[model samples]
Target: MKAEYENPFRPPYEFLASGGMVASGLAILALLEENPLPMEIRIGAAAALFLTALVRGRQGWKVFQKKRRLTRGKRFLKEETEIELDDVREIARKNPKKLWIGKGFEWSSTHRQLMKEVQDNMDETKLVGPLPKGEQSKYRETKGAVWVHGLEEEKNEKDIFIPLPDLFGHLLIVGTTRAGKSVFLSLAIAQAIERGECVIVIDPKGDPDLRAAVERACIAAGRADQFVWFHPAFPEKSARLDPLCTFNRVTELASRIASLIPSSRSGGDSFVAFSQRALNAVVNGLLQVGTKPSLIEIRRALESPAMLEELTWKALDAYCVSALESYPSLRDGAYQANAKSKGGKRSKCDIVIGLYRQHVQPSKPNTDLEGLISQKEHPHEHFGKMIAVLLPILDMLTSGPLAQLLSPEYFTDVEREMINIGQIIAQNKVLYLGLDCLSDAMVGSCIGAMFLSDLATMSGQRYNYGTIDDPVNLYIDEGAEVGKHIPFIQLLNKSGGAKFRITIAVQTIADFAAALGNKDMATQVLGNENSWIALRLRDGETQKYLADNLPETTVQYVMNTQGSSSKAGSTEFDANLGERLMQEPAELYPSAMFGKMPTCEFVGNICGQVVKGRIPFIKREEIKQAA
Candidate 1:
């Protein structure tokens, strides 16, 4: 074997060459001391030796230069470029074509350059403007351009920076697992908080990352007392409401469901309406006997002549009895038991976190029609009161004999009442519901839909004057898998333009689209998001979607590349060079797509101008240790 091959870790051949020169210089000096030469010749030889030594001494320096360039390039490419918030002109979703071509290419050249293009075309003047004066000083100026970060590679320099809007109506995020969706949501939340705005986080999966972030935020604001945990199964001990309140809430919900029947033209709608009306009358009539009616009193009222006269009243009596029989403890207010506390006046919680355990069958039966119906039943099996709330009264009404007479026209008032109740909850409180450990997908959807609808209703009423200007944030993590609620998305889309801002975290576009049942709507939601941060994505469709939607230069630089040819007709060639070409230059590309674990960064209008950066992500261990 060759000597160089024998010692694999030895210095390169260049080092050996330099060593030889040093040896030669020493030999020359040794010979000169022994043998006198002509003065002129000796002088010339001495000068040549000196020059050779100088060259040999600095031979290793060339390697350092190469390393320096690589380091500088990496830093320049990865460092987040600051785009002041003020100069932000507009923050709209980039068209597929626009994102594909416009992001990396320079107006004056065809060469695919990264950082140079960003530096050259970036609206430097807008990026570096005077800070706002007075109370406005508390708010940071909006970053005019969007920065793209990739999941796999160092941040690219050729990343696209589109002009951002001063104010975005709303933002929608969609992605699958580890797609950097949560990071994206955190970014938005952090920004919103920095602006001194309020935020309400609704996390169905009980993502610890999101929970920890919110906790830190509360602590930072000196408002830790505002955090509230609302577990339906475990009610607050301090809650002043009596058993009557529980019956009233249920009755009110039933009445609202009954009213919704008119909006439905199907058998299901009529059935639900009749059932809801009956349940409401039964529950309310029984409760009217005293402050809190007993199960016996409820049964007596159901059998009374006054109840039999109304079709809805009959249905209510049957459902109530059936529910009590199924869960006997409910008769004693077990379902509505309050939480245990030490007894000082509890803090007026600004955020209410709800933890509901959903009972969902992981695998559905393989039967045909029966199986389909059984699948729908899985959502209903959850323990939360929300399911009971959404269950149509029509089901109960149609079960016995009144099914034939039930009509949509009879339930209008019920539906309106439901909407009104939702509005009340949303308007009355700044609720931050964190639904932890959701096992079933449907339960998540139900929770998301119900709350989103409530928020939408309240937002529309201007019932509460809150927005990005004086905003409230709704944070959701792993939203697609945990919940597939179209109405919630629609609500978010609507609210983005209103006073509220919603942040959703998901793993992939496909998962979100599948859950939403509409690809276009999913695209609209994701695109409209003021900020989008992408993490490592392995799915082809997701990668394609990102490539198609990102700036053109970025797509070309990050996604398109030619295969390398073997050098000197040999099969082996340098793979690193090919990687370098394909690798997103962090300075040029702010976002990346390919890596073992990649992360993409984005910002838009919904985040508001003030929240450029201030999101926190503390680990559970860190929080515990700190506490």
Candidate 2:
């Protein structure tokens, strides 16, 4: 469409003006001639002048209309607009199959050029001073309207919507502080809740308004009972979530915890590897004794040799009893003989070790169980040093209410309900995980990372088996804090096939790089997301990152050259007037424009198309009514 449309500024105005002046001068000279011409000739010449003037006036009017259009377009673009609750309900009903992103339209190359034009031509001085009382009140009504003062638009302003299927590819929202990341999240989450999809929000900072918005969304959707809130600070009101509750293998649980240890660069891989092995050993022993593994239990087993001894003894006794039923009578006899004392005296561990060495080790051995007993037999002093880095992390997670929160004793603590990703998806529930990072970043990050690992495991399960009926919409606010975790990357990679729609919000790309300690790791995280919503980005690197993703465009500018020369007496004067069109390769949207965007306003690449949209402050009045 842009290619076919002629430039509105490109009309022959200069030529028409010159011709109009020349014709009027000729008519005057004819009228003032000393030898008057015939009346018919004069009248014909007068008609010719009139025709020239009319043509020139028509062209001038076109230029005027075009200028007005440019002004109207800018005003439309900057108008204070929002999506009310009634509008939301209407859109949901009309487009029952599509995803309503926000209220805006496709921002094409024409719009980009027009915005540049507006920026170059607008009067900056007029923008200063106090606004009209009514206008100021309107601006105060919503944060989005305040920043649209200088924004521009061309045409086709309407609601921004996308296909429901595009969500499988995932979405990434990037913005600076106080730049409406939470506002956009609230709207998106509300839509998902309204759609009856399973929504899981992982908010590290734990914005209270955002939590209220989700609660309101659930209430509006008539699914208030589905809302499950988990916050470490409010254990009495919060739900219990065991990150280690469900895993295909014990090693997965170990790897999930081990990932939190400092990388191999700071601490050698040997230390991390040993820590994982130690976790695996403890987890296996607990499973062998029919006990569910939890953070507190893992810490106790690692910190005390007595607990390890008890686990080993109980596991060995259970294995021996099982062996009597499964194996031959002779094997049972061997197990009984190994339980007897040696020459002087034998300890309980010694008897367990003897039975394992004689009966279990020779025939059929539980390699998982063997790892536990081997760690038990290892020199205590050396083993402690090997797992030194792993203990403190466990302690931080197990301390205070976190111990029961992360590791819920379902049978004993009946007040709090337990939540797992599998159940959250199957039952179509809304789970909001508030890590409360402001209070404790380390603990919050660890919990978030482990929850991501558990989510990754659940995605794997969905991928291998079959998908559930409803799609899972997962929103991770302040993603950079936990986004560096390996499981997060894995979740992004595997979530598509598992019917998961993931949206990650970050302050800036640099934050992710800083958290991951590598730029390439940050790139890896961003690469998995197919769509991006960029709000006011102040970081230079973040701006460049966004601009780099969009394809370059040709921007045309007019270059005018004027020259006049005067020669000696017999003075000859000549003037040459010429104009040229110069084209330069440029980003569709300048990197700096992102810095100037208003709150709740965004320029996004949804799927493949670009969009400039505004997210309204969705009302929660419906929450009160629904309640």
Local distance difference test, each candidate: 0.39, 0.78
lDDT score for residue 27 of model 1? 72
Q: Give the per-residue Cα lDDT of candidate 2 at 103.
A: 68
Off by over 4 Å in 2: 1-80, 125-155, 265-268, 325-344, 564-575, 622-627
lDDT of 1 by residue, 1-627 (tens): 211112111234555666766677667666775657765676577567667766765755553333233223222232232221111111112221111101121221122242333344444334334433553434333322222211112332343332223123444454445544665555444344434455667777766666566555445444455444322222221111111122224444343233333233332554454445444554543433222432223333333333323322223323334433432343223223333344443211100101101111113211221221222233332312322433333233332212211221223342311112232233322234554336534433443444554455545544344422444556666666433543455555666556555556666777767765567757766765665434455566765665454444431232234565567967787543322223232212222322222233232222322111111222222222112
Model 2 vs. true fold: TM:
0.84
> For each candidate, what TM-score against the reference?
0.47, 0.84
RMSD list, candidates in order: 19.6, 5.9
lDDT of 2 by residue, 362-393 (tens): 77677878888889888999999999999999
Q: Which candidate number has the best TM-score?
A: 2
- Candidate 2 residue 132 Cα shift, in angstroms, is 5.9
lDDT of 2: 0.78
